[model samples]
Target chain A: MTQHTTGAYDEELRDLVSRIAEMGGLAEGLVSEAVTGLARIDIARAQNVIFNDHRLDDMQRQVEERAISVIARRQPVARDLREIIAALRVSSDLERVGDLAKNIAKRVIAIDGQFHTKRLAFGVEHISEITLEQLKAVLDAYTSQDLDAAHAVRSRDDEIDAMYTSLFRELLTYMMEDPRNITFCTHLLFCAKNIERIGDHATNIAETIHFMITGEYLQEDRPKQDESSYIPAGYSSE
Target chain B: MTQHTTGAYDEELRDLVSRIAEMGGLAEGLVSEAVTGLARIDIARAQNVIFNDHRLDDMQRQVEERAISVIARRQPVARDLREIIAALRVSSDLERVGDLAKNIAKRVIAIDGQFHTKRLAFGVEHISEITLEQLKAVLDAYTSQDLDAAHAVRSRDDEIDAMYTSLFRELLTYMMEDPRNITFCTHLLFCAKNIERIGDHATNIAETIHFMITGEYLQEDRPKQDESSYIPAGYSSE
Candidate 1:
C-alpha cells in the first residue's frame, strides 16, 4: 500500500516537471517565431506566435493547479515543498516569456506594411537568438537540476543586457538619421526590449533552480550592463 | 494543545495578509511618486522611487515565504487554500507594479537633461493617474474579498487601455514631428507603456480576487481598446 502511494506521488511530481518542460519548449518556439516574424515582417508567422500563446497560458494554469494540489495532498516540506514552489515560479516566468513574445508579434503586425526598414530587425533578431539560447539552457538545467548549468545561465544574462544596450543604440541611430524611420524603429526598439526581458526571465528561472537545489537564494546582485536605462539616445558619455 | 496550534496557524495566515497589504501600499506610493517625478523632472524623487523598489521586493519575498509556510503547516484546502494562493498572486502583481514604476523613474532620469518638451509628460501623467487609481481599488478589493468591487476594477481596465492608446498616438506624433523630439518622446513612450502594464497588473489582481472569492477563473475576455498595437503611428489606417 505504501509503495502504491509513493508511486502515485512520484508520478504527480514527475508530471509537473514534464509540464513545465513543455511550457519552456513552447515558450522558446513562440519567441523564436515572433522574432523571426519581426525580422521578416511576416504577419502570418507573427499570428501563429500570437495564437500559440494561449496554449502556453493554458499549460501554465495547469502546472500551477497541479503544483498547488500536490502541496495540499502531500503536505510536502523541505525539498518536496521547494520543488512544487519552483514549478510554480518557473511556470509563471514561462508564461511571461510567452506574453513578451506575443508583444513582439503584435509589433510585427503593427509594422507590417510600413516596411521602411528591414535591416533594423537584424539586431533585434540577433539579440533574440542569444536570449532563446539562454532560455533553452536554463530550462534544461531546471529539469536536470544541474547547479553548474543554472549558474552558467545566470552568469550569461549580463551579456544579453550588453547586447540589448547596443541594439538600443542602433535603433536610436536609425531613428535620428531620418524622421521617417521613427515609427518602425520604435517598434524594433520595443522588440529588442522584449527579447531582453525574455533573457531576464530565463535568468529568473535559473535562480529558481539554484534556490531549489541549494535551499539558498543566490545572494549576489545580477550584473546589469543595460546602461541604456541611464543614457538617453542622443547623449554620449564619451 | 490543539487550540494553541490552531491559533498559531491563524497568526501565520494573518501575517501573510498584512504583509501583502503593506506591499500594496508601497507599490501604490512608488507608482504615484514615479509619475510625479516624471511630470516635474525631479531626479531626487525618481531616485527615491528606484531605491524604494527594494523594499517592495523584500515585502513580496516575505509574503511568498509566509504563504508557503502556511500551506506547509496547515495543509489548507478549499477556501483557506484560495486565500493563501490569492496572497501569493497579489504580492506578485504588486511587485511587478513596483518594477514598472521603477522603469518609469529610470526613464525620468534618462530624459532629465534633455528638457525637450515639458508638455509631453502631461499625457503620460494623465494615463498613470488612472492606472494608480485602478491599482488602489483592486488591492482594496483583494483584501476585502469584494467580488463586485473586483469586477468593477476589471471593467475599468478598458478605459486605461484607451488612455494608453491615445498617449501612444500623442507620443508618436511628437516623435514624428522632429528628430529632436524623437529621443525624449521615445523615453516617454516607454514610460507610458510601463504605466499601461501596471494597469494590466491591476486587472490581473482583480481577476485573482475574483477567483479567490468564487473559486472560478474569470472567463470573459478583458476588453482592450489598445488599437495602437495595430496602427503604425505614421500610417493612417483609413
Candidate 2:
C-alpha cells in the first residue's frame, strides 16, 4: 500500500515537470514558426505567428502566477522554491523570445513579399538554426539543473556573436558592391540580428539557471579586451 | 541661525541637482557625437566616442554608489529616498545610454571608411535626428519631472519607430534590387537600428521616472479577448 502511494506521488511530480516542459516546447514552436514564416515569405503564416503571440504571453503570465501561488500556498523551500523561480524566469524569457519572433514576423509582413538578397536570407537562416539550438540546450540544462551544461551553452553564444560579426561585414560588402543592394540587404541584416539577440536572451536564461543553482552570477567576468594594449581607466569591471 | 543652516542644506541639494543635469548633458553629447561620427564616417571621432564611454560608465557607477552612501548616512525618508533612488535608476540608464552610443560608434568603425548608398545613408541620418530629439526631450523631462513632458517624449518614440520601419523597408528594397547591396547597407541598418533602440531605452527611463513619482505603471492596458481567441488558459492579469 505504501509503495502504491509513493508511486502516485511520483506521478504527480512528473506531471508538473511535464507541464513546464510543454510550455517550453510551445514557446520554441512559436519562434520556429515565426522564422519559417519569414523565410517562406508566407504572410498568412507570419500573421498567424503574430496573432498567436497573445497565447504565449498569456501562457507565460499564467505559469508565473501559478508558480507564485503554489509557492505561497505550500510554502515551498529549498529545491522546490528554486525550481519554481527558475520556471518563472524561463517562462518570462520564453515570452520575450516570442516577442522577438513577432517583431521579425511584423518586419517580414512589412516587406510585403519582397525578397532581399538570397545570401542575406541564407545568413539569417543559419543564425536562426544556431539560436534555436541554443534555446533547446538551455531548456535541457534548466530541466536537469546541470550547471556545466548551462555554462557550455553560455560560451556557445560567443560563436553566434562571431557569426553575426562576419555576416555584418559580408552584408556591408554586398551593399557597397551595388548601391542598389541597400534596400533589401538592410532588412536581411535586421532579421539576422534579431536572431542573434534571441540567442543572447537564451544565454541570459541559462545564466539565470546557473545562478539559481549556484549563488554566483555568471556575468561576473569582464568583457575580453586585448591584454597587450593599455587598459582603459575608470571602467572597473568585476 | 536655524534659517541659515536650512539655506545651506538647500544649496547643497541644488548642487547635487546640477551635477545630475551635467551628467545628462554629457550623455546627450556622446549620443550626438556618435551619430555625427557615422554621418561623416569619421573613424577618429567614432573612436573618441568609444574611448570616452568609460568615463560616463564610471561616473554613472560613482553617482549611484554615492547616492546609496548618502541615504545610509543621512537616513533620508519618503520623498528624499524616492529622489535618491530616482537618481540611482537614472544614472544606470545614463550608463546604458552611453553604451548605446558606443555601440553606434563601433558600427561606424566597422564600416571601415566605406559608405552605404545615399538612400540608406539618408535613412540613418533621419532616424538619428529623431532619436536625438527624443533624448533631449527625455533629459528635459527628467530634470523638470514634468509627467506630461515625459509622456510627450514617450509618444514621440512611436514616430521614431515609424521612421525605423521606413528605413527597414528602404534597405530591404535596395537589397532586393541587387544581391550585392547586402553588405554595406547591412552595416548602415545596424547603425540605424542602434539609434532606434537607444530611443527605446530612453523611453524606458522616462517610464521609470513616472513610476518613481506616481507609484503607478504606465503600460497600456491589456485587452481582453473572447474565449475563442486562443488566449492561454488558466491565467489572469491579477
Off by over 4 Å in 1: A1-5, A233-238, B1-5, B236-238
Candidate 1 recovers a fraction of native contacts equal to 0.52
Q: On a 0 to 100 scale, what is the lDDT of residue B151 in model 2?
A: 81
Best by DockQ: 1
Candidate 2 ranges with C-alpha deviation above 4 Å: A1-26, A55-95, A115-120, A169-184, A219-238, B1-27, B52-96, B115-123, B168-184, B219-238
> Global lDDT of each model?
0.84, 0.66
Q: i-RMS values of the candidates, in order?
A: 1.9, 14.3
DockQ for each of the predicted structures, in order? 0.59, 0.08
DockQ of 2: 0.08
Tell me the tens digit of each residue's lDDT in model 1 across A38-125: 8888899999998888888899888988887888788887777888899999999999999999988998889877647687778888
Please tell me which predicted candidate would have the highest TM-score against the true structure. 1
- Give candidate 2's error at residue B174 in angstroms: 7.1
Task: Supply every candidate's count of residue pairs whose N, Cα or C atoms clash at under 3 angstroms.
Answer: 0, 25
